[model samples]
Target: MNSFLTSGLIHAAFWVVVGLTFGGAVLAVFPRKIVYNVLGLIVCLSGVAGLFLYLGSFFLALMQLLIYVGAICVAIVFAIMLSPPLHLEVPKRRMGKVVLSAGASGVFFVAIAAVIWKTVWHPAAERGADWSIVTIGHLLLTRYDLVFELISLVLLVAIIGAILTTGFSRRLSS
Candidate 1:
């Protein structure tokens, strides 16, 4: 057997990470406590960062840590703090709704899997092999200029909106 994938250490690490990610999802979405859910989301996102590292995208993995773990998760934490207690029990889902949701997600997953498996992925006919950060930046500015600009604009708008909303709410309440 190949030692890398089948080794005891590797297997242990893989299973642990999988368990953490799955468990985190359960924690984040389930339970009445919003705090626990947020904690779970953080754990889940960290696991995703680990997965990104394993997938040979160290840059993406670091970015995942910096952005998702740092910014989005922090924002969620702040939101939760602004809200009520986490100990409240949310209403249980109806069986039919649960089944429908499961069915919908399952179908979507299967459809995506089928499309991925059936499709043939080919690089451009005469693609240049440039995977450097500089190359990516260049591509972003030239080929994906609009998308790049749009994302920055969106983030800026979101920040301004968040500030405006919070300021307005405080004034109105006062």
Candidate 2:
């Protein structure tokens, strides 16, 4: 009974996270206000982090929150605040552009769907029973080498941008 209940709860949580991710994505795209967009992005990122948690990757979930939600979203908020014209009027989007965007999105979706459908997914023949931190670290450093390097690069850029922005603000104030 306890196992069943736990399984049910996990399934429910997974759906909830998926809902949050899609809902936030919609909110982010459809909002006219910049602040609303940023907030929606944060929500979306948080949802993605939740999804990572649901996938049994605590490390990925933590990284998603730390790098995307913690750093990127916060930086965007700061940038928005620092910049003038918070309430700048947005120009009305043209019908032609909207139609073009929609068409492109549809094509991309179809292409991606086709690729996914065509691809044969194979799980590892011998699945490792061991789920250790050391194993994860080794895999990340070895197999996912490029991804780790890219993440580091992104972090470096964010730090540099923050430093430059702070110095520029101080100079402007003085």
TM-score of each: 0.53, 0.54
Count the clashes in each prediction.
0, 0
- After superposition on all C-alphas, the RMSD of every candidate to the true structure, in Å, is 12.1, 11.4
**Best model number under lDDT:** 2
Q: Please give the lDDT score for candidate 1.
A: 0.77
Off by over 4 Å in 1: 1-6, 82-164
- Report the C-alpha displacement of residue 107, candidate 1, in angstroms: 40
Over the stretch 4-82, how does candidate 1's per-residue lDDT look in tens digits?
6568776687778888889999999988987898899999988888787666677777767867887788777766555
Per-residue CA lDDT of model 2 for 118-142, tens digit only, reads 9987665456445576577678779
lDDT minimum window of 10 residues, candidate 1: 83-92
> Roughly what TM-score does model 1 have, to 2 decimal places?
0.53
